[model samples]
Target: MPSPAPWLYWALLSALFAALTAIFAKVGVKGVDSDLATLIRTVVVLLPLSAFVWLAGKWSNPTALSSKALIFLGLSGLATGASWICYFRALKLGEASKVAPVDKLSLVLIAFFAVVFLGERPAGREWLGIALISVGVIVMATKR
Candidate 1:
């Protein structure tokens, strides 16, 4: 094939991985502690990510990354860990469909944070997307 169009493949793979993650996590948490389950899931994730890092030869490029970049990466990792903890706990206590939609509201929080901290100037389209996401979350929350 002609290089297998990168963006399309990546989007599809990301969706597949996200869906699989929720289902697998939901099943994995059954009869198991959520925190321990999240830890196990992280271990599973690290295997593939570690292989990709090694294959990309990023281990030798220590100096190329700035301290600011490293700091942001560490912060992002911390946020992701916190999100996973909340998500698993929510899944353990609530319906998967419900928890998933609530977790997705993080996109709204991220967009607002980007504007406040990253000085991001979102265009009209992005603003519209944020509004729609907000409405969806509200609707999901209100449904009995």
Candidate 2:
């Protein structure tokens, strides 16, 4: 088969890392306050990410971007922080299998939000995939 797009490769890698994050965070949060654990994780991420930004020389480029890009990036950072805080809390209290699926409900929300806020029109197949993801999350998150 022909190779998939480059973005698909990155997306698959992202999913793999995210799965590992749930497992690792679940173990890391044991006997620790979830918010504090999230803070520690943030520091862990920052240390390496900072080094990467410096090594890649992308740090100064942020200033070259428009103020609108900076503002949106700042907002995205805040949202990511909030998501991590809640995710750690959920992992602390619930099984990773359960929490992970519910956490992924964000994908369905993202599809809808993109259409509404970003004016991105998904194709019919994409909408079907989104609907299937919504249903899978609901099924997985529901208690037996």
Candidate 3:
């Protein structure tokens, strides 16, 4: 059998870590202020990421990036911070299974955004997959 693509490997790792994040966050937020929990988590992530960039000699000259790139990256970071705050708050109040599935609804939005903003046209089968994901999320999110 042929090896999977590099992107597939990375994506699988992402999924694994995301699952862990939901589980861990669900537990960590218990009896804690959700915003404070998010702050602590952000610190944990920042410390390791900073160490990795510095120790691995992967640091880049921020000035070299174009203004547009910088602006977009800044906006993306803000969006991420907002998302983390909301996610932690939700996990504090809801079951991880249901919360995680609702969060995955972003996948459907990503597919639409990629086509509309990135001009990337997915094949018909890909659209079918997106539709299924949409339906699955609805099913998973609904109460019995």
- Clash count list over all predictions: 0, 0, 0
Off by over 4 Å in 1: 1-12, 61-64
| Model 1 alpha-carbon miss at residue 124, Å | 2.2
Question: In model 1, what is the error at residue 133, expressed in angstroms?
Answer: 0.8
Misplaced by over 4 Å in model 2 are none
For candidate 3, the TM-score is 0.96
Query: TM-scores of all models?
Result: 0.84, 0.94, 0.96
| The candidate that achieves the highest TM-score relative to the unseen native structure | 3
List the candidate numbers ranked by lDDT, top first.
3, 2, 1
* Cand. 2 TM to true fold: 0.94
Task: Give lDDT tens digits, candidate 2, residues 1-44.
Answer: 99899999899999999999999999989999999999999999
Task: Name the candidate, 1 or 2, with the larger lDDT value.
Answer: 2
Scored against the true structure, residue 67 in model 2 reaches a CA lDDT of 97
Candidate 2 vs 3: which has more TM-score: 3
Regions of model 3 farther than 4 Å from truth: none
Error of 3 at 143 (Å): 3.7
96 Cα displacement, candidate 3 (Å): 0.4
